[model samples]
Target: MKKIRWLPSQQDSHNRWVVFFSLLMGVLLDSISWSGDWGVAIPDVTPLILLYWVMAIATNNFLVTAFFFGLLHDVLYHTGMGTYALIYCFLLYPMLHLRLQIRNKTLVQMSLFIGVWMLAHQVLVWLITPANHLAMENIAFWFAIPISILLWSFIFLSLRVLRRNMNVR
Candidate 1:
């Protein structure tokens, strides 16, 4: 029988800081509000960032990470407790399961998946919050999906470069 190790090794431990900072950046990006109605067009950056890290790094336990960050998001956004936490966990579960297949996909293919993913996230947010019920009718509400899809390549490439440069396993 094989045993599982929960703790990261000395070298692997360094990646935690990297992942933390990147997710923090995502949090920051998510918190910023765009001027006027443009805000609705901005996609949720944290999840996209989370998706990148989840797909890139296999060893780390992102479910807990996602939960924590999602909690942070809920607090930051002043939403109900466990709202984003539940959403993040729900979204990341399939990604965690299909990480290998997703990792192998080309950037264009990945963007399409990301579009669907973001759409789902938006839908989840709409359903979870009563305030967002009317948002679905707005054109900008749907803009988030395509905007996130466009950002996918940039996020993926930059994070890939960061991981490679940092030598994160």
Candidate 2:
């Protein structure tokens, strides 16, 4: 079996700012958290981006990226402080640890992982949401897990392409 890589893969020689811009795209995408349909729990794009970088790049800086993104996520989305920051870290740590096992897998398999991740996030959100006075009444939130799984391939591909095109580590 291939041993896990705790460090990031080889990176571009220059232009590290591209990585920051790419991550910013994710935080910006979080604005779409709300979907008009009541039955569709929108996939949290920030976590998707966070998981991707933690897995694809495996950089030491990933945690800091997650922290900043998560903080920005909460502020932009108007949720509680440290809410998404904690959630991002929660998902990031595991993905980083498991990256070796799953790195070679196809997107379909990765979607299964994303599905479980989404469920876990929802559970935690349900537990902590009341602190922010948020109500989880929408029937669509139930649909989020499957929707995120189904969309995982697209999201993964898109982010991967962006990462590659930008030559980001």
Candidate 3:
């Protein structure tokens, strides 16, 4: 009797579905708008989710996926085309480059790192979108950094569980 060997591509296909669903959740969360000043404080979920996957899965290049999700966000929010696409791709670059090292960091350390990364994301958005200038001046805009930092553990743990349960490599 011969034993069947599981292929690496099979594992990657499974990982792709898991990654897609998680990123979809991030897009959905990002689409929700709050009223008044509170809206500004809403953390950017997609990028955080992207960051997690980039760190978790070392072999895949999520840049294209990030770009696709960004385009989806643009369409959903009716933003200028490529605004988010560029942001996501640019932000993901560093993560992809340092994913190996980042994977070893403690959650606390990673959260701080995410905070900095997200700050750059915000700054990039501010720079690219002129309409956001006023919002950038608002304290709530800055508040999002802390909010994202707080949510990091939750996102990390939940996704970690999901990845394990789904047997994603």
lDDT of 1 by residue, 1-169 (tens): 8999787687877888898899999999988978887688899889998999898888765998999999999998888989999999989998888888988999999999988889999999989977788896787988999999999999999998998999888
Model 2, stretches more than 4 Å misplaced?
1-16, 33-40, 131-136
Q: Which residue pairs show collisions in model 3?
A: none
> Residue by residue across 69-161, what tens digits does model 3's lDDT show?
989988876889899999999999998888888779999999999998989988888788777888756979888889999999999999999
RMSD of 3: 3.6
| Model 1, residue pairs in steric clash | none
How many residue pairs of model 1 clash at the backbone? 0
RMSD for each of the candidates: 1.6, 5.1, 3.6
- Candidate 1, residue 85: the lDDT equals 99
Q: Can you give the TM-score per candidate against the true fold?
A: 0.94, 0.80, 0.92
The model with the greater lDDT, 2 or 3, is: 3
lDDT of 3 at 113: 91
Query: Which segments of candidate 1 are over 4 A away from where they belong?
Result: 1-6
Please list the C-alpha lDDT of all candidates, in the order they appear: 0.89, 0.73, 0.89
Shift in Å, residue 167, candidate 3: 0.2
Whole-structure CA lDDT of model 2: 0.73
Q: Candidate 1: deviation at residue 104, Å?
A: 0.6
| Per-prediction backbone clash count | 0, 1, 0
